[model samples]
Target: MLNGLKVGDKAPIFEGLDQNGKKISLKDYKGKKVVLYFYPKDNTPGCTAEACNLRDNNTLLAEKGYQVVGVSIDSVESHKKFETKFELPFPLIADIDKKIVEQYGVWGEKKFMGRTFDGTHRTTFLIDEKGIIAHIIDKPKTKDHYNQIIETWEK
Candidate 1:
């Protein structure tokens, strides 16, 4: 488990394909605050709700100068469907190899239906303009976690 990527740690660098099949790199988002969230899969109830929350709050987040991105081990095609279904305005990265997930320490053992499995653990990282992690939300919720992040940013 990541335990967490604490404040002041260098934000993990990643280069992955987006839903549109375009490559996206964490370095490309440098000089701006970035919200990188990791979820287990797309279209699942909790993941859907969490993504919707980020989608709905995206405008405000942009106004606040934060770029919100969702990541999962799902394929680019799956991300496309999820983005369309939710009308999401931001990019969602396809991490099929789970490399980025492992780098950020979001991929780990999790208990689901009383069975343990290795999967994304609903983690969110707030990387500052300097590309250093400013905060980490390891126990992410399906709603208002975006708002919670904004609040944290305000502090």
Candidate 2:
């Protein structure tokens, strides 16, 4: 397993298309902190709750000068539907190939119905202005995620 990235390591740069087909690059947020979260899929129960939590706190994160963005293997169409349904203010990148998730080490073996398959392991990464990862929240709780993010920024 690629322990791909860790706290204190520089965040990997990636370019991908957002829900609306807009090009997004991690490099664009050079001078701002980034809350880059990865979830399992679109519209699923836990995923939806987690996404809405982040979506609700989007403005707070922004006010703290942090950019919040989510990534998943869902296609642009699925992303569009999810965003529209929840009115997510932040962009959700479509990583259908899981390239970005794989690069970040969030894609791998996961248990579903007690069966194993390659998929994303719901995780959150806090990337600082210099592109270095400040924190890595593996197995984040849907309800506590936003509060944890805010607490992270306060520290």
Candidate 3:
């Protein structure tokens, strides 16, 4: 098992192409709080719900000084389609190479319907402005993810 990051750990920095083919680097968000979330796929039910929840709460998250960034092994084209279809306001990183996901240690074995396979885990890392991990949500509540994040930070 890869050693995943945790609270108080310095977040691993990486860059990838966003849905629009724009290069987005973790270093660019240095002075801003970042919510880096890793999911299994694009256009999936749970993933869609989580993304929509975040989209609906975008203003609130922005007002609270948190910028959201999503990462998945899905291609840029797939991400673009998902964003356009769902009106996602945040940048979704297309980690097709799996570099960023591996760096963050979110890629792992998962079991679904009694079938086991390696995949990206649904994880969220709340990073403070200094790039230190403020909190790590391993089992995020898809529908109430925004509230969970806000409450975690508030606590």
Q: Write down the lDDT of every candidate, Cα atoms only.
A: 0.89, 0.89, 0.94
Tens digits of per-residue lDDT for model 1 on 48-121? 99999888888889998999988999999999999998998988999999899989988888898999988898
Regarding TM-score, does 2 or 3 come out ahead? 3
Model 1 clash tally, residue pairs: 0
Q: Which 10-residue window in model 2 sums to the lowest lDDT? A: 1-10
**What C-alpha lDDT, on a 0 to 100 scale, does residue 62 get in candidate 1?**
94
lDDT of 1: 0.89
**1 against 3, candidate with superior lDDT:** 3
Clashes of 2: 0
Give the poorly placed runs of model 1, Cα more than 4 Å off. Answer: 1-4
Model 3 agreement with the true structure over 29-143: per-residue lDDT tens digits: 9999999999899999999999999999999999999999999999999999999999999999999999998998989888999999999989999999999999999999999
Estimate, for each residue in 1-155, the C-alpha lDDT of model 2 and write its tens digit: 25568899989898888999998999989999999999989999999999888888888878889898899999999999999999999889999887899889988888889899988999999999999999988868896788988776677
lDDT, candidate 1, residue 55? 87
Ranking by TM-score: 3, 1, 2
Total backbone collisions for each predicted model = 0, 0, 0
Candidate number that wins on lDDT, 2 or 3: 3
Which candidate has the highest TM-score of all? 3
